[model samples]
Target: MTGSIDRFDEVVDEAWGRAFRGRPLADRVFYLASELGDFSVLWLIIAAAQGLRSDADADESIRLSLLLLAESILVNQGIKRLVRRPRPAATEPRPHHVRQPGTSSFPSGHASSALAAAGIMSHRHPRAAPLYYGLAAVVATSRIHVKVHHASDVVVGAAIGIGFARLAARVWPPPGER
Candidate 1:
């Protein structure tokens, strides 16, 4: 089982190297996109600022941000310890490939937070759903492009993010007025 998992990780890493890594322009874009989930704080700040415009909007943003922050912690600090999977090591990362998290890689925290934020925010503001989802998708994929996580890592992270967001939304309903 361990051998199979190692093989899978290796194959995915190889594919990522061929397709995404070493590409100058794309590497930079993906590196920046991944920062959207950095500490899950950027999204939180955006939510907090947006919340200032209207109470309902603000409420949803703050709620979603907080939920995402909690989810990020759960994935990064909690689950990652159990998984203990190291990140895909890039032999020679570009200048933009800056993040080097000293944590497990099975569940990309960035991916999780991005998806969670998207799910929660999209639920509150349906019209901006596409944008929220798109950003999450980019952040999730960027984890792989930057060699910080395997494809499966980001995939599972996204699932966790979406699931947690749904759970949070159901348990703690956001303000509704538009």
Candidate 2:
């Protein structure tokens, strides 16, 4: 089982290298995305913007921001500490500057937060669901493009994010819904 997992990581690393590592344009875009995703900065910005519309929007924005904070703490502090997985080694010099996260690489915190934000935001604005999820995809995948996380790590993180958002909805619901 360990051998197979190692092989899978190698294959994914090779594929990611071919797809995104050296290309200047992809590197720039993904590096920016990854940086923006740090500490869920992009999502917080969106939430603040959403808050400007009305009182209800402001309330939802506050809730989303709080949820994002909780999600980050849970994933980064709680889960990463338990997993204790090391990130991929720096095999070659990176084409762009990327922050080295000091956390376990088994489940990506950026991916988790992005998906959780997307899910919660989408519930409030169903018409903008595509935009929400599309940004989530970019933020999540950028972790891979920048070689900060394994594909499986992002996948599992996204799953956890989706689950967290669903549970949040059940417990709190949206502003209008019961």
TM-score between model 2 and native: 0.96
Best by TM-score: 2
Per-residue lDDT tens digits of candidate 1, residues 1-178?
Answer: 8787677767887887788777788777788887766787657876888789887777677677678768867997899999898777677736674667889888888888888888888877789999889888888888878778888788888999999988887788777532
**Residue 1, candidate 1: C-alpha displacement in angstroms:** 4.5
Query: How far in Å is the alpha carbon of 134 misplaced in model 1?
Result: 0.9
Model 2 lDDT per residue over 77-134, tens place = 9999999888888788888889999889979998999999999999999899999999
Question: Candidate 1: misplaced stretches above 4 Å?
Answer: 1-5
Which 10 successive residues of model 1 have the least lDDT summed? 90-99
TM of each candidate vs. truth: 0.88, 0.96
Lowest lDDT 10-residue stretch of candidate 2: 1-10
What TM-score does model 1 achieve against the real structure? 0.88
